[model samples]
Target: MRGGAELSRHTTTVIAGGGVSGLSLAAHLAVADHRHPVVVVDDGSHPLDDRTWASWSDRPGLLDAAASRWFERIRVHVNGRTTVIPLGRYRYRVVRGSDLRSVVRRYTDPLPHFTFHRGHVDRADQDGVVVDGDHVRARWVFDSVIGPEVPPPSEAQLGFRGWYVRSERAAFDAETPTFFDFRTSQDHGASFVYVLPFDAHHALVEHTSFTASGALEIPRVQQEALTEYLTEVVCTGGHEVEREEHAVLPLHAAQAQRRRGNVLTIGTRGGLLKASTGFGYQRIQRDSEAIAKSLRRNGHPFDLPEPSGRFRMFDAVLLDVVTRESAQLERAFGALFRYRTAEPALRFLDEATTPPQEWKLFAGMPAPVYLAAAGRRLSS
Candidate 1:
């Protein structure tokens, strides 16, 4: 404590970042408990922008009605062939940042026990969060300010650059989305292009890479990739880009700090982002809900389910393969999708598959690389 610094406020919970993860936990807590107030603190440096979160679900989700697009099948390009995987009971949905912000606000804004505290947090811990030399005391703190906690020198990073585009004529099939088109150069890393078509003339096409180098090309390279794809692949004569979005996410084995006293990390910082594929929307949702249920039922949010050890091994090995064999990323994925069905793969990636199911899925994979990677990880 500074000589003159004092406790500025006291709340039941202090969320250190007002991004999706922090606000999500706040909303969950506020709804589950009425006596305890939840406060979300933020620096507001990041304004809501063109980012989108995409996930698939067998049942309806909180933001499904507001989703920007939906697809029931995924088309994959691998080994000079195309494979279409049908999602039997699941549907893929893309939710925009603005929509997610509004949805969560509708849940927190009207509650008297909920508050949105604005300012940059200098420090956050179990005792409270310090902002502008004033400390806000709280019983618990959910921190999402990642900083340097993720993508350590040992981890891989996923980089992306994409555009929301409108073609001059009918150039896309609105019903299906290209989950992965591994036609891009692999010199940088495991790179692929994906298209989320909203209609015959409009889509959000992007190029994403999983790399250990953590490097991405901007206007020159990104623009060229899209131009070539739209012209040759989409067979389009002309197109206009409505918006461009770029981002990077850590691809590392997530180690959630759930047992820590009153200071718990959430979201990407908490290891909710899957290390192998870089997906996290559904994982974050599951974690937030579990945390709230634990707090409501057990009087503590730390009562959460443990991640499977096998999945941890799987994620680690796949990440090793991605980094070691960047040039054959498509081949590894192709082995998994050889069944022409995506439901099992989705469940496996979601970490909900059983041992037998997992075995069947991996049996078709060309396993020499995976075995070597697994051996190295296990020995180390």
Candidate 2:
């Protein structure tokens, strides 16, 4: 029973890591069956406390009801210049993790077949997963707990800080969320400021860095950088900070393999994350949906399927190119925007929709540089 309250003693599907991916998978499994026993284990260090999950989507799903804000235009800035890209039919939506948890709990709490345990997963093995010496057996185990080590084959790190602030005066447009304000200097790797304006006077401002390696004073640096940007670029002076949000995500272009016997990887650990953008929320949802569909169709546990081969190859080449030459990112991004429609580009990044001609155009941009980087990575 996936959702029934009756304890089955032992479960068939045991998921380790109760974050977005794990919880979502559990919910999907529950919806699929009322008899498949599913248990989710969390170490208590849930990242859901202070993070915002935002992604571009044409259709709505789990987080649709919790969407606090949305925008159709994303502003990009580079070296004091700004470009506003209209999303056309696409909308960039945001939903806080706390809200997501609340929604999942509402549905999952009633089900007897679903159980959530608060504990640490020490290690995962071929048979099952070990949680604080308690061995839990399952036909399939989906793991989402990945640590700092196990670097992606070829990837870069991006350190960033997000702050939710209430301004003293109304300074932001309530209709549009400033996706990337690239007006800041690109000297320290590639730096940018993003604003997710909740209303006219409140927004989540973040200072982001696309660099290889560095220790950052997140709070101090974010405040300072934000203060400077607000006063200079945004011209929103004398604003008061009310609340803050911060995080560091590795923008790695790593090739992740699936399968450890019956144990399978999910979420970022499963290479469901976008290598270039560090966007995993939508990808996680999509991956979980696919897995659920597979389970329903197969009527048994199975090994996880790999992501699109073409997408992986493209990401690998792009990552190699970016790693070898950081300066080309801005140009590459600019070309992508200039050549392709915003909708298609967003779809491509989300791995939802892509056209063959668009891919051709993508490969054509910076042909010499891309080819060289691809060749270098392949040879290496």
Candidate 3:
């Protein structure tokens, strides 16, 4: 019985790069209908393991069945002291990528219109995507593959490593996520320690930066930084590493253009990445929803508007301000949070998600250097 179904031929809407964006789009497509065929190709046979994705939101309506480790409070450390910000209305949530993949896969697999192909994509073009020397044609393609050396807005390359670990002796309040622990010296281009505790005994610790250029031993460096922070700063010892996740996201303003002519690019490859923070999950989710709505209305895939010039200009200004005055990050962030609601700040960081009052407040923050940088960007 299984053999007969497996041998059946089905037309598919091909999606390349089965990461969060790809999988989410597939799930949306699956939920939308069973008439149109949807196919996803990924290099990994198994779902991504040992990785945690953190996002700040009041509700968990973005992705269904996502693992939501909620924290009503956050701590920001600077100048050798920690300031706890009680976010009664906001909750910081994290979802493991593996969990997201598994849930999406389970939901999409049952649909006869949905299919997943495990292979490496050698090239993608207007015709279709070529996977491992095999050509598969589709009416339309959605691509998320991003290559290195893409033109970046800035010259700096920021990178970091994160790990999930469990400790027995350490005292951990799982109710709160340490948003920023800036106890480390900012001399090395703004370094900080961040943690998200799922339970009293387990947490994901990460060492991140605002400026990390050129080639780096990402795993080794992240491991060392995490261990050092855990042992020396947090005073937590006897911790066993459960898993490790590492990534090098360009903090600089990098422009990733749409390639595959018939293929409409979604997610990071479509330049949905936030120019300042490198956070793409929420933006990509929103982008996917918009694309899905368009497809549903038009009855076919189409190119997205390439992200508005106004949004890009705003992002470029913010990126210029941050990179030029890396030292003022703490003060700038403090002012933003202290003066405005978390919701407005989150929206502003994601681009123009703020009212006029919130925008004025954000603009009023103290950063003469950043203001100068912004002016330069505006002039340019």
Number of the predicted model whose TM-score against the real structure is largest: 1
Tens-digit lDDT string for candidate 2 (140-179): 7888884333545645656677777777668887877776
Give the higher-TM-score candidate: 1 or 3: 1
lDDT minimum window of 10 residues, candidate 3: 1-10
Which candidate number maximizes lDDT? 1
For residues 348-367, could you state the per-residue lDDT of candidate 3 as single tens digits?
Answer: 66565645755664664565
Put the candidates in lDDT order, highest first: 1, 2, 3
Q: What's model 1's lDDT at 145?
A: 77
Off by over 4 Å in 3: 1-9, 45-47, 59-62, 79-81, 146-155, 212-225, 252-255, 303-311, 339-341, 358-360
Give the distance in Å from residue 98's predicted Cα in candidate 2 to where it truly belongs: 2.0
Q: For every model shown, what is its TM-score relative to the native structure?
A: 0.91, 0.87, 0.85
Is candidate 1 or 3 superior in lDDT?
Answer: 1
